[model samples]
Structure formats: structure tokens, C-alpha cells
Target: MTSTERSDTDRQGLSYYPWWLDNLADDATLEGAAMNGTARGAEAVRTIVAKARELYEFQDFSYADVFGDNGFLEIYDSSIQGEPLKVVVTVTRNAAGQAQDLAVLHRPRNSLLLFSRLMHEKCAGTPLAAHFLSDDSKA
Candidate 1:
């Protein structure tokens, strides 16, 4: 599909299945402002994303568009625990159109910390927990 068409679809809101979900490369990586380090592998990325989404009370995308040949960007406003949160997500795909890298940036340090702490709590006892702040840290 063309860039314009993709943008239009994005504006309409993400579908039940986002394009990148099934198209992630086996070695895809996820990194973000709230994460302590990058999470690698498609399964790990999927798990991390699912957990993160579960924490969001709501999300409203302000901008979602394609950039260059294999780059997609999404900027959205969301809330977690009734606090306002803004997120910028960028995905980079391989030549075959499989997502290779997914990066998320969360704004407002307080919100980020809250989100990170929540993530840490939820991911505890799992390998994903290491990618988030330790429970001992101040949220």
C-alpha cells in the first residue's frame, strides 16, 4: 500500500491486529525510555508490548505515518493510573518488510517513572522484569 493509504488507515485507528505484530523479524528488538535496556527477540518484544498495553487506560493517536521506505512512526496521548502520558513509537522494518526494531519514547519523567514501576511490578519473576526498573527504586 502507498504511504498515504497507510497514514489514512492509521488515523482511523489501529486495527485488531497491527501490521507490525505479525511481521516482526525473529530477532526484532524493543527499546524505550521507560525500559532499562533493549528487549530482544520477537517473542520477548511481543510479551513486553502486550504487558505495556495492558497498563494503558486509554490511547489516542495524534499522528501515525510512514517515513522513508521502512520506517513507521506513531505519536499518541494516553493515560495510566489517571495520569496523562504521551508516547512516540518508531518502527523500522527490514527489506522484506518485517519489523526489526521498535522504539518507544514516553514523555514527562513522572509519568514515565510511574509507568516503569507499574511495568516492573507486573513483570516481576519473569525475564521481562529485568528490562524495567527494580521495585526498590522510587516511582
Candidate 2:
């Protein structure tokens, strides 16, 4: 789609999906992209799609709850190597109906470990692995 069409569709909501996935996929990428100022810019969008492809085998996100009219939680039933992962993504939007912030919360134990393992495999040499790996200095 053209940039204008993309922007219009993003204004609709598919735009936020990538940022949500980026939060799940790689923190460094998200931070780096965010450095450019706008979360919905090209760098962030590319990172989101790349991370989604790298990490999740399949994902089905549905509206779990809505707070008032501008905030909501989206629950993702995702699979990695056939294992189930339940992730809750919470988002807050501005008055103009644009997302302002997003938070991703993963289920404990099995799901967290699965995500870490995927991060280790996918992120390897990247700084994003720290988001999953424990701090060695604390030991």
C-alpha cells in the first residue's frame, strides 16, 4: 500500500499491532526505533514485522477488555514450536485515538521460559537477549 494508504490503515489500528509485537520481540529494536521520535515511523514498523516473523509461529489476538473508550487489553494466543503462550498487551490511546503507550505481559513460568528460549535462539548476538536472560552481575 502507498504511504497515505498505510497511514490511513494505521490510523485504523493494524499499525499498533507491530509496536505490540516489537515490545514482545525485541526491546533494543523498539528503543532504537523509538529514538527516532515517532513509534509509528518506518524504522519501528520494519522492526515490528521482522520481530513478528522471527519469534511467533502463529498468533491470534483478540480484545480481552476495554477500559472506558481509549484503553484496552488484547490477549494473544500465540504458538512457538507448538507450545502455547498467553500474552496480554495493554494499550492506552490519546484523545485523537492514537496509541500513546503499550505494555506486554506474558504468563509466568512455561510461557516466560518459552519466550526466553526463543529470544536466545533468535536474538543470539543481539542486545535484545538481555530482556530474556538473567543478569549475570547479580550472581
Candidate 3:
């Protein structure tokens, strides 16, 4: 669910913490901890989410009717397990040729960052998953 779904309101102040999460008083971003209670590795999920947001924003998927072209995956999610989700985004050309397709995969519950970048690279056939992930144009 979106972060908003988990927030609450109280007499003293606004509570953004979701009852499902641990250490409610602690911020997840501190010490580089992840929402799933994992250490540095948890950052991986944040990485994915960041990627998804990039895609959504770049494509102008902010409105409710827009329904961003991005998709999500939830691997080993606290709410589920062993889910490998994938999504593809398409960019049609105005050059009279068929529209091009780009895959954007989200590993189960990942934030859709690293893997999506890899998938986009693979779709573009730019040495994805092999090299040049950080620098797509270099390879």
C-alpha cells in the first residue's frame, strides 16, 4: 500500500508511522536501514522504488487517470513471499514505424530501481546486465 495508507492522526501531532512497521518512533532512512528491517541491503528496495518514481514522473503519470506506465514487484515481501513481478513500458515513435517496447521489471517487492534500469537497458540492447548499467550510453 502507499505510504499514505499507513499514516495516522493523533491529538498531539500527525503520525506517519504505520502500525505494521517496527520501531515506529525510528525513521527508516537513518543509518541506512530499510523498511523491511534489513540493513544496507534494504536500500535495494528503496533503489527500486526510486526507479519506478523516475519512470512514473518522466512519463507524466501523476494524476489518478494517468495510471503511470510503471509496475511493481514484491519479492519476499513481509506481506507475501516469492513474488517475481515484471512490467514493460512502451514508447511509440512518430516516425511511422511500430512502437518500441521497453521492459521494466520489479523484483517481488523491490522499489523498481536497479533491476528496472537493467531491464530498460536490455530492451534497448545496450549491454544490460553485462556492463554499462550506471552509464547506459557508454557501452
Candidate 4:
């Protein structure tokens, strides 16, 4: 699809987290034609996808409530393995569903490399995260 068509859907059908993932995916590919900034982007996306899937996996699934009120999830990027990481990602959901809020449980300083951290704040209908805009650090 063209850029205009892509933007049209951006307003509907998908939420911010999934949309960001999509963009990162494009950055990883040759279609966009960019020669840089995508090598690690693609790896980060795949790691994130795997992390999200683990939530529902029958085996190796935590099932235990990791984050009581803040959405939390982790992505282990093998793309830039051994390199330190320093970026922060927050995935929040307004709809009532299984995958609702995504929060940043912990942050790494000097190094952005964090394969995983405590993630998942509220289930779709639980609404216990305090509108997502809440400051978990203070709470």
C-alpha cells in the first residue's frame, strides 16, 4: 500500500503498539529502500512478538501476576546482542481486552540493553492500572 493508504489505516483498525511494531518491521526490510537504521529494528520486532506470544503460551507462561497495576512486557533483541540498550517503550490500551496496558517496569542506564523485564499491568476488562497515564514509579 502507498503511504497515504497506510496513514488512512493508521487512524483505524490498529492500536499504537501494533502500529509501532509494523513501522519497525518496515524499517527492517528492503522495500522501504532505506540503507540504514533497520538492522536492529527487525530483530527488536521479532523479539517483541515472541515476548507477547509467551504471555499466552501453554508452557513456560508466567500466568502469575507480574505487574499489579502497570502493563509490562519485554523484548529480547538478538539483533544487537552484547550491545547495551537505553530506549524506553510503553504500550497502553484503552479497549477492554486481554492485552490492555503495556508498561515499562524497569529501565537500564548507560546501556539500553534489556532483554526482558516485568511487564503487563492490566487485563482488557480489569481496568486496575489507573487509566494507564498513571505514574507507576510514584505509585
Candidate 5:
């Protein structure tokens, strides 16, 4: 698809946080503790959403339309690291019904180098910077 073109997913108005997610309230929390130098609420939301978009290469998927819940757990076949792989992503919603957490399981575990690199690059020199080079990357 062309970069300027919108996919059917886009036509459906998928976003980092869909309207249904507002049920979580403004103080809703994501899974991880706040990274150093970042605020807890909105900053956490932006950072986590940005990271997911980067990892998924901006593909849009709907939790409501696909799973009829806050989130879904699925395995994706990806070649982002230059070979076939199965990556498991578990998305969960907080009690308030906001999709607030994401966990990814790399099949080989060590296959996350590219993902880490991209995150590090994107987060560099900002309060959003992550210690992804260390074990804290999992946050």
C-alpha cells in the first residue's frame, strides 16, 4: 500500500487509544512503572503507544472489532529480523476497560535486538529515553 494511502483499518478509525478506552478515566495506569524523568499518566500512555506502533510497523488492528474485549493475545509471523519467526503479543485491559498493557514474547528471546535498537534510537535524548540496553527494557 502507498504511504499516503489509508488502509481499511485506518478507515475504521483505529488509534492508539480508541473511544472505548476512555472508560479507564484520566488517571488510568499502564502496566509498567513510570520511566525515570517521565510523568505517570499521559506520558506513560504516549510512550507505550509509540513503542507498539514502532514494533508493529504502524499496522492498525482493532481490539473491539477483532476480539470484542479490551485486548487480544495473538501470535504474529514476522520477518522484521530477516527470518521467519513467531512473536507472541498479549494485550490486556485494565479493570476500567482501557487496553493498558502489552507484553511481547520473542520466540528465541534473543531475537529482540532490532526492536531494542529501534526503540533506543527513537527514544534517545528525551525524557522518554529508555534503559532498553539493559534489562529494564522490558518495562
Candidate 6:
């Protein structure tokens, strides 16, 4: 897709082709509330993001806009395992327009706990598992 092209929007007006998906830099990093520390590299970021998207039962974007010279921000309401979740995602891009940093913030302690647990379950047995809560930890 070209810079001017936008992907399809769902009923909730969420873009199917969010800018970050296609623009993540090779050494991109991901960090946020649901993560233990940080996930590095494009492949790791992609894996985590794809799994998170799958766990969301519904999403309605309330706001999305450019943040700064090379940043984009998105805020949305969503549901996972029937629990309501609110998220703010910020993406920072490199000079080439490739996303270099991605930050995700989830709200509502209860919802964040549930989301983190679910993510841990899905990432089990993978290298990415290290960046999530262990089974022994409280969800």
C-alpha cells in the first residue's frame, strides 16, 4: 500500500491496516503494561501484536492521530474474554518512516491482569514467554 492508501475499517471504524504494522523497523522495540520488560526486534513485536489482536473480542477506536514529527497515537476501547479494556498505543518512527518504538498502555487493573494472563497463556513455550508473567505469578 502507498502512503495515501488506507486499509479497510471494521464496523467500529478500526483500521485493518494500522500504520505500524507495515512500518516497524527491523530492530523495533515493544514495551508496556502487559509486558515484563521489553521485546526487541521486528519478529518479536509482530508475534506479540498478532497474538494480542487475536485475543481482543472487540475494539472500537475512539481517537487516533499524529503525535509529533514522527509519532502516532491511538486510543481504543476493547474487550477480551468478556472483560472491558482500554488501551493507548504510541508508535515512534525513524527518519525512514519505519516504526522504531511501540508502546502499549492498558487500563483498569482488573482488565490489565486478565489481558496479561491471557497473553502469557498464548505465548507459552515460545521465546516471547520471557517477556510475560510466569504461571506462578498472580494474574
Which candidate gets the maximum TM-score versus the true structure? Answer: 6
Relative to the unseen true structure, what is the C-alpha lDDT of residue 136 in candidate 4, on a scale of 0 to 100?
32
Question: What tens digits encode model 4's per-residue C-alpha lDDT throughout 1-139?
Answer: 2235444333222322444343343233211011112223354444544443343212111122223344433332211234333222344323332333333322243122122221123222322122222223322
Instruction: Please list the C-alpha lDDT of all candidates, in the order they appear.
Output: 0.83, 0.50, 0.27, 0.29, 0.47, 0.83
lDDT tens per residue, model 2, 16-82: 4444333332212222211212234434434434664466655555545567787767666666677
Task: Give per-residue lDDT, candidate 2, residue 123.
Answer: 51
Residue 96 alpha-carbon offset, candidate 4, angstroms: 4.3
Stretches off by above 4 angstroms in model 2 are 1-53, 64-66, 134-139
Q: Of 2 and 4, which scores higher on TM-score?
A: 2
* Model 1 C-alpha lDDT versus the unseen true structure: 0.83
Q: Candidate 6 lDDT, tens digit per residue, 21-136? A: 86789999999898898999999999999999988876677667788799999888888878899999999999999989999999998888788888889999998987777658
Candidate 5 lDDT over 24-115, as tens digits, reads: 33554444222233224645555654564556533333222335466756444444435333455555666766655545555444445555
Q: Against the true structure, candidate 3 has what lDDT?
A: 0.27
Q: Which ten residues in a row have the lowest lDDT in candidate 2?
A: 27-36
Of candidates 4 and 3, the better by lDDT: 4
Tens digits of per-residue lDDT, candidate 3, 7-40, equal 3332111322212122111222211111112212
Kindly state the number of residue pairs that clash in model 6: 0
Clashing pairs in 6: none
TM-score-wise, the better of 4 and 6 is 6
Encode model 1's per-residue lDDT on 1-139: one tens digit a residue.
3336546444434442457877889999999999988999999998888888888776667667789888998788888898989999999999988999999999889899899989988899998998888768754
